[model samples]
Target: MKNRAILIILSLLLFIIVTPSQAQTYQTGSYQTGVGIRMGNTGGISVKHFMDGRHAVEGILSARWGGIGVTGLMEWHKEAFRTEGLNFYYGFGGHLYLGRYQRYRRNYYYESRGAIGIDGILGLEYHLPRAPITGSLDWKPAINLIGRTGYHEGGLALTVRYTF
Candidate 1:
């Protein structure tokens, strides 16, 4: 019917008009690389590599409770507020933890079991105009899939990483 056709056309026009036209500005090239320590009892260094205007990958290496681990993350970001220099991102990643520990009192010990898990991250980042400095605060929650050990196995961490 003509009424149905008109409704569909109106909806498409509204969608196009309401959508924001903007792109995220990213620091690229070798000079844009950054290295900084993230805060928390489990401290780590974060490295970010921008693949394009809207995508990036990061790697983290940290030590906690005498264990060392590595994590890799991929994120998709969107420019918010249009040049307000703020970016919001969501990502999923995984990690590996390894170390050594004692098992029992009967002269028994074993290499600490390595752990693997998936994590979700939500964060906001700010970039200063004309400067190579960037800062971010993120909440990351991870679920242990391999070694189910303690209460601390699943929790949230607030992290800040400096980007060049």
Candidate 2:
């Protein structure tokens, strides 16, 4: 737990330090960085950064039914219809689930282990041109490839983030 905290902190520091230097390389929709919470079937922390006008990356740390999971994604974005500030994005990523879960049924008990999975996302985002807030609605589907292998379908999220 302690080591995980340190690694998360270090990663955020590196993102903050490295982002600005690469900022001038490309144009962005609204703000270059955004951080906030997401609500859906699961609750999580979300951070997104636009490396350029059409390319972005996102990271999520989620608390779910079985355990905690972390996901990373690389995305491509394009303008949505003729709407200003509205964009649609598609991405592919992966997740790592950690922690153990146990179910008790009278005298019988079952335990489940953590798993690693692949993730795909499709979403619509609106970055308000005059405000520091960005709102998005997205669907993420995941398929477990390790541990207990299966497909997970409930991965919709609504997010409101402060951009800078």
Best lDDT goes to which candidate?
2
| Alpha-carbon TM-score of each model against the true structure | 0.67, 0.77
lDDT of 1 by residue, 100-152 (tens): 54456468655456778765566777776666676777766565577743223
Q: How close is each model in CA RMSD to the real structure? A: 11.6, 10.7
Model 2 over residues 1-164: C-alpha lDDT tens digits? 54564355456445543543322333456688999998896459999998878789999999876679899988877667657788877777899888776778689886667889887777899988889999999888777888657676646789889999
- As a TM-score, model 2 comes out at 0.77
Give the per-residue Cα lDDT of candidate 2 at 49: 94
Clashes of each: 0, 0
Candidate topping TM-score: 2
What lDDT score is found at residue 160 in candidate 2?
A: 89
Query: What lDDT is obtained when candidate 2 is compared to the true structure?
Result: 0.77
Model 2 off-target regions past 4 Å?
1-28, 104-109
